[model samples]
Target: MPQWSEQTLASFERKAKETKVAVMVTGSIEAHGDHLPLGCDLILPTFLAERIAQKTKALVLPPIPFGESWPMDVFKGTVSLRAGTLLMVYHDVMKAVFRHGFRFILALNGHGLNTPLLRQAAEEATEGTDGTVIIVDWWSDLAKSVRAQVLESPEGHAGEDETSEVLAVRPDLVDMKVAKGARVRTAFRVVSASHREELLPRGVYGEPEGATAEKGKAIMKKAEEELLLLVEQLEQGKLPITEK
Candidate 1:
């Protein structure tokens, strides 16, 4: 299958007549934990995008590796773009894809902080173009299924779900020995707070211990299944597009 992008002129022309549903995966260069790599967010969605493309025969766009990472700004290697800038980036990408004749666009996002921003971007993209934008936060989409399969406390930055996923994808990157202890943060609304350091002193939340590669594999598998169903629904015009 062809990867989606306006840059690929030949492939775009070849798939021009085919169903024009493009999948763009977005992630970030941020700290996962002591055990997981900084690019964990990027890798997970990229992995999912590949699986989704294979299942739906949709063109996969290059994953965006930078996102809004203000909470993890203290951590080394955490790179973040402003939320406004990130939204503009998505808008431009969507416009380009729509210009290439794609009527359906999926924003397969991996980062948690980018959720609200992407939501806004997707709405804007849809309004600005004739193409439909479907936003999918893999973890959020399959959270219930993941919780049913993984027995660990699923609450950290590099917590159970994330660690398990990384272990499943790239075991060599995880330091099992360092993946100990739990860092629980007091729950507070970000809307009322100006200082993030007070809430997350260690740049993490939840328990990191109990993560396993098996659990990650199970979570990923469930995610793929859900995505396939979603794609089918979208193709059949069953998925509802709501405005915010």
Candidate 2:
């Protein structure tokens, strides 16, 4: 499948009708750490979407690079969007894709804060219509078990898992020399605006120093397999939920 941004209008229309599915990657421009790039969120999901689309033949939409990151807004590179504004952006994009007769949309989210809003936007976009949207937070959702298998440290912003992934996709951008983090041991969730600063003073939450390209490749391979399975199911009319 072709990237939506690169497709000619005529080719896109023709291919979209044949494909009937699209994959959109969403993430945030935020502070990952001193070592990782601010665009870490976008890089991983965009990588996943491109890999999956190769097999599934789904059109890959351009990435949505800003998300709700108010918790990390204090960080220098963090660009946070208001909840409503992010929701509207997602809704509008999904609706536009659906309107073009591509009913199945796989929204691969990279930021945790964007998950609920993405869900809401997906629901609103497909309501009263035959369209269906599958929202996947690639790291938390697809790579959860893989993290346990391959990662030595707990997951957090720019942690072992994420650093490893970035290394696998773009090793040139990673700086392992200064990679560091504090082990975050949270009992439960709390609403503290200064959470990142207080708990993670270094702006990192896990052991990024332990990150390796091998672990990252392992995580990505599992994610790709699972996503391929999902796309297969959707193609077979076995997804998008059916009420009992």
> Top model by TM-score, which number?
2
Residue 115 lDDT, candidate 1, scale 0-100 = 86
In model 1, where do residues sit more than 4 Å from their true spots? 5-8, 190-198, 240-244
User: How far does residue 64 in candidate 1 sit from its true spot (Å)?
Assistant: 0.5
Worst 10 residues of 2 by lDDT: 194-203
Candidate 1 per-residue C-alpha lDDT over 1-244 given as tens digits, one digit per residue, 9 for 90 to 100: 5566543666667776666578888999987767789888899989888887677767788899999988777777889999999989988898888887878887888888888887787787778567788888877666565666575675557788788888888898889897755564456656323565545544556666888889889888888888777777766755555579
Q: How does model 1 score by TM-score?
A: 0.88
For residue 35, model 1's alpha carbon misses the true position, in angstroms, by 0.6
lDDT by residue (107-147, candidate 2, tens digit) is 99999999999999988899998999999889888967887
lDDT of 2 at 150: 88
How well does candidate 2 match the true structure in TM-score terms?
0.92
